[model samples]
Target chain A: MSIDPGMLLAIAMMSAVTYFTRLAGFLLASRLSLRGRARAAIDAIPPAVLFALIAPVVLTHGWPETLAAAAAGIAALRLPLLGVIAIGIAAVVILRALF
Target chain B: MTVQSEYQSSTADEIRQGLADIAPVLVAMVPIGLLFGAICTTKGWAASDVWLMSTLVFSGGAEFAAIGLWKWPIPYLALFVSTALVSARHILMGVSLAPKMHAFKGWRLWAAAWFMTDEAWALGERRARRQTITVAYWFFMAVPVHLVWVASTVTGSMVGPMLGDPAAIGLDFAFTALFIGLIAGFWKGATTAWVLVASGGASALVALTIGEPWNVLAGAAAGIVAAWFTATEPDEPESSSPEGHLL
Candidate 1:
C-alpha cells in the first residue's frame, strides 16, 4: 500500500473532470429541445464521430489501412457487424504484411 | 399470468440480449485494456494506482493522454485539463443519449451515466433506434465491459508492459476496425455520406497536423455542420451533387 496520495488525488481529479463532462451533455440536452436541423445534426453525430475517431488509421496511417477500411466498408454492405470487423482486421493485417 | 410477471420475464430476456449483444465487443476489448495498463506501468504508475485509474476514470483516450503526460513530479493541473479536453466529446454523446433513455427513471439514469463510454453510448443510441432502452438492458451492456476493462488494467499492471508496439501484429487496428463496424449501423444514405466525408476528412486532417483529441472535435463539428447543410436542402431527393462525385 505504497500508493502516493498525490497520484491518487490526481487521478481522482481527472475522474471528476471526466464524470462532469459525461453529465454535461445529459444536462444540456434536457435544457434544450432537439428538432428539425438539430435533430438531423444529432443523427449525423454517430457516424461522424465514429469515423472521425478512426480517421488517424483510415486516412493517415497509409494506403494499406485506407484500402482495408474501404474493404471493410464494402463488407459492411453484405455482412453483419461482427463479420465486418473480422474482415476489416484481416484486411488490414494482410495489407500491412503485403506492403 | 399477471402483467407484472410478464414484464419481469421480458426484463430478464432484455438483460440477456444486452449481454449477448456486447459479448464480442467485450472480448475484443481484452487486448486493448491490457495494452492500456501495460503502457501505464511502463510510465512508472503503480499497479494499484493503474487499477484505480481504470476503475474511476474508465475512459481510454483520456487515460492514455494522462499516462503520456505522467512524470515524476506529476502535472496535476495539466493532467486534469487535458483529461477534460479529451473527454469533452462525452458531453455531446450524453446529449444524444438523453432523449433515448426513457426507460430509466431519475436515479437509474444517473447511475447508468457512470458506465457510459463512447461504445456504450453509441450502442444505447443504436438500441434506441430499434426499441426503448431500459436501465436493465443498458447496465447489462455497459457494466460488463466496464468490469472487464478494469480487470484488464489490473492484469496489465501486474504483468507490466509486455506487449510492445501493438501495431506490428495489428492489435492497434482492432479498435479502428470495431469503430468502422459500429458506424455502419448508423448509415443513412446521402446524408451519411456527407457526414462521413466531412468528419473523416476534417478529423484526419487535424490529426495529421495538430493531433490527439482536437481531431475528434473538429471532425464532429464539421460533420454537424455538414448535417445541418444537408438537412436544409429541399425535401426532394437531389441527384448526387457533382461535388460529392468529385471526391
Candidate 2:
C-alpha cells in the first residue's frame, strides 16, 4: 500500500473543507446575537436535526424498519441508552425475519 | 459549598459521566469503522490513505462518500463537493451546539468543535440539557470517539474482515436506535412532537426526492420554523415554562 501524491491532495481537500464546516457554524452563530423566537429555533435544533437524520431510515426503508423504529423509539422513553439499542436491534432483526 | 470546590467535583463527575455517556456509541461505531476500513482495503486503497482520511477528515459519512466516489483518475471536484455536502450538517450542528457550551473558553471551544460528530454533538446537547457542559465532560465525551474511530478504521484496513450484510444482523439500526434514545431526551410534549413530525416527514420526503444533505437542511429548517411558530418563547431567565428554564 504505497502512498500517492494525488491521493494526498484529495485527503487534504476533504479535511480542509470539513474542518471549515465544523467551525463555520460556531463562528456564524457568535456574530448573530439572537434572542426570543430565534433562540427558541436554536434550542429546537438537537431534536430537529436528530429526526431529520433518522427519518429516511425509519419512514422510507420499509414496514419492518418503520415498525422497528417505533419499538425502539418507544423503548427510549422507558429504557436506558443501552437497553434502547438492544430493543431496536432485536425488533428490526425479528421484523426483518418475519416480513 | 465553595464555587471552586463545586467546580472541581462536578468536573470529575462530568468526566466520568462523559465517558459513560459515550460508551454505547463507541460500541455502535465498531462494526461501522471495521466495515469502512475493510472496504478501503478491498478497493485497493493504501493503508496510509485509509488511516489519514479517518484521522484527518474524521467524518464517517463523508469518508464513505469519498470511497464511493474514488477512482483511478480521481474526480477531484466531485470528491471535494461530495465530502463538503455530506459533512455540511456539521454547520447546523455547530450553530445549535455553540450557544450551549458556555463554559468552553477561547481556543477550547474551537478545539472541541473538531470532535463534534453527530453522536458527539447529540450527546453533548443531552448533557447540556441536564446541566452545564464542562470542558472535562465534552473532552472525555468527544476525544475517545475520535480515537476509537481512527483505531478501528486502521485495524479494518489491516484485517479487512468480510463482514456480511450489516442489515442482516440489525447492526445498521444501532445508530438509529441510539439516536432515537437521544431524541427522546429532548421531549417537550406537543411542541416537540410537531417539530419532529415536520422535520422527519420533510427530511424523509426530501431524501426520497432531492436526496442527501439537502434533506438534512430542508428538514432542519422546517423543524426550526415549527419551533419558532409552535414553541412558547423562553425569553425570560426565570420563567416557569419548561422551555424558558432550559433554553
Candidate 3:
C-alpha cells in the first residue's frame, strides 16, 4: 500500500516536538537557575505526574481496573517492584475472569 | 574531568551490567509496545508510520494520544499540539537527569537525552542516588530498551490482530502496570502521598470532564501547588541541577 506523505510529515513533526522536549532540560538548566521551592517542585514532579496518569485510567475504567489498581498500589507499598507488577497483572486477569 | 574520562573509558562489563539492570523493565515494556503497534494498524496507520513514530517519538503516551485523536481529514494542528502536551513531562524528566549527565559531552550527551524515557529517567535517578552513573551504563540500559520497543511495535502492527482483542486477555493493563511499578519506586514519604493524592485527584477530575491529555498537565499543576503548601522539616533536597557544573 502506498504511504500517505501527509501522515509521514505529521509523524516527522511529532518526532521533532518530542525530541525538543527531551532535550529541553539541559538547554533550559543552563539559562535558568532553580533553587528552593522551584527545585522542590521539580523533585516532586515524577510521582505526581505518574499519579495523574494512572488516576484517570483507574477512575474511568470501572471496577476491574480500580480494584486491580488498588491491589497494585497496595502491593507496591510493601512488595518488591516486580512483585507489585505481578500481583497487579494477576489481579486484573483474575478479576476479569470472575466478573 | 576525571569522571568524564572514566565514564568514557568504561569497560564492556560495565555496559553489559547496565543492560542487566534494565532487563526487567524491558520485559514489562514488551506487551505495551506490541499493543501500540496493534493499535496503529487498527487505526489504519501505515506500517511506515508506525515504525517512524515508535523509533522517533519513542513515547507511548504521546503516540497513543496522537492515534486516539487521528481522523480521516487529519487534524494536523491538534495532533501536534496534543502530542506535545502529553510529552511535556519529558521536559521535567530532562531536568531531573541533566545533573547526572553533565559529565557527558557532544553527541554522547544528545544520545542520552534522545533515549530518555520515564522508565530510563527513574532507573537512572535511582542509580545516581546510590552511585555515579556512567555513559556506558546509561547506553547499555537505554539502547536495549529502545531496540526491544521498536521491534515490539513492528511485530504487533503486523501480527497483533491475530492475537484477537488484547483487552480480553488483560494485556491492555500492561501500561498501567508499568506506570504503577515506576511510581512505586518514587514513593518517598508523606509528602509523596499528599502529592500523589492531589495529582491523581486532579487528573481524574479533568479526565471525567475535559477528557484528553490536559488531565496530566492539570494534575501536575495541582501537585506542585500542594507541594508548595505542604510543610516539612528543612532537609537537603535529593539532587540539584549543575549550576556550577554547567559549562
Candidate 4:
C-alpha cells in the first residue's frame, strides 16, 4: 500500500498523544500531591478506564458474537491461557461458519 | 559499595526479576501480540512497521485502535485525541507510581513511562504498595513484557498470514478469552462489577445509536464517570496493598 503523508502524520500524532497520556501521571503526580477527593478520583480511574476499553468491543459485535466469545472465555477460564485462546478462536470461526 | 557495582548488581537482578514477574502475563501477551502482528500484516503494514509499532507505541489497545482508524482518513488531530482518550488510564498508572518513583531521574523516568503497559502498571503498583522502588524491581517487571511484545509482533507479522484464518486454528479466541479472564480476575467487588456492567451497557447503547469510534469514547466516558461517582472513598490506600496481594 502507498504511504500517504496524512496517514503518517496521523500515526505520528497518535503516537505523541499516547505518549503524553502515559507520561501525564508521572509528570503530574509528583508536582501536585493529590489529596482528599482528588485521591479518591484517582483511585477510581483505572477500573473505569479498563472497563471503557473492553466493554465496547464486546458490545459492538452484538450479542451473538459477544455471547459466543463469552462462552469461549468461560470455557477457557479454567484452562491454560493457550487453551482458552484456542477455544475462543474455534467458537468464533465455527459459529460464523455455521450461521 | 561502589556506584558502578551497585548499578551492575541491580541491573542484573532486575533483569532476572522482571522476567520472572512478567512470565505469566508474557505468555498471554505473546499470542495477542502475534494476533496484532498478523492483523497488521493482513491490513498491509510492512513487517518492519509492525515491529516498529510494538517497539515504539508499545500499547496494545492504542495500536489496535490506530490500525482500525487508519481507513477513516481521520486527521492527525483526531487520531491523537482518540489515542489520548483511550490511553487515559496511563495517567492513572503514573499517578499510582508517584510515591514509589520519587527518586528516579532523567532517562529512568522516561524509560519507565515508555514501558508502563497495563501488565507492567499492575505489577508495579503491587510492588510499589510494598514500598519497593528499587530500579531493579521495576526493570525486572518491565523488560520481559516489552521484549515479548516486540518479538511476538515480529512473529505474528511473519506467521499470522501464513496461518490463514486464525479462526481455523482457533487462535482468534485468545483475545476474547484473555480479556474475559482479565475481567474475572479484576472484578473484586460489587462496585467494580457495576462499573463494568454500566460501562458495557452504556457503550452498547451508544454504539447502537452512534456507531464506530464514538461508541468506544462514549462507553469509556460513561464508565469513568460512573466509577468516579460510585467509588466508596478517596485515599482508599492504593489497591495494590503491601501484602503482595492480587487486587
**Model 2 agreement with the true structure over B82-130: per-residue lDDT tens digits:** 9888778889888877766667778998898888898999998777665
In model 4, what is the error at residue B166, expressed in angstroms? 1.9
Q: What fraction of native interface contacts does model 3 preserve?
A: 0.60
Candidate 3 whole-model C-alpha lDDT, 0 to 1: 0.77
User: Which regions in candidate 1 have their CA more than 4 angstroms from the true location?
Assistant: B1-9, B232-247
lDDT, candidate 1, B51-110, per-residue tens: 889989999889989999999798987898899879888888888787666556677877
Model 2, docking class: medium
What docking tier does model 3 reach?
medium
Which tens-of-lDDT digit does each residue in A1-99 have in candidate 4? Answer: 355565566666666777887788898875545554455445444555545555555666655467666775586447644555556666766666776
* Rank list by TM-score: 2, 1, 3, 4
Q: Comparing candidate 1 with candidate 3, which one achieves the higher lDDT?
A: 1
Clash pairs detected, candidate 2: none
Model 4 bad stretches (over 4 Å): A1-12, A31-37, A60-99, B1-17, B69-82, B126-133, B183-188, B212-220, B233-247
Interface RMSD of 4: 4.6
lDDT of 4 at B205: 77
Report the TM-score of candidate 3, chain A only.
0.78
Better of 2 and 4 by TM-score: 2
- Which parts of model 3 have CA positions greater than 4 angstroms off? A30-35, B1-13, B235-247
Q: Tell how far residue A52 is off in model 2, in angstroms.
A: 1.2
Please identify model 2 stretches exceeding 4 Å from their true place.
A31-33, B1-8, B233-247
How accurate locally, in lDDT, is each candidate? 0.80, 0.84, 0.77, 0.65
Which lDDT value does model 4 have at B143?
Answer: 72
RMSD each, Å: 6.3, 3.0, 3.3, 5.9
- What lDDT score is found at residue B188 in candidate 4? 42
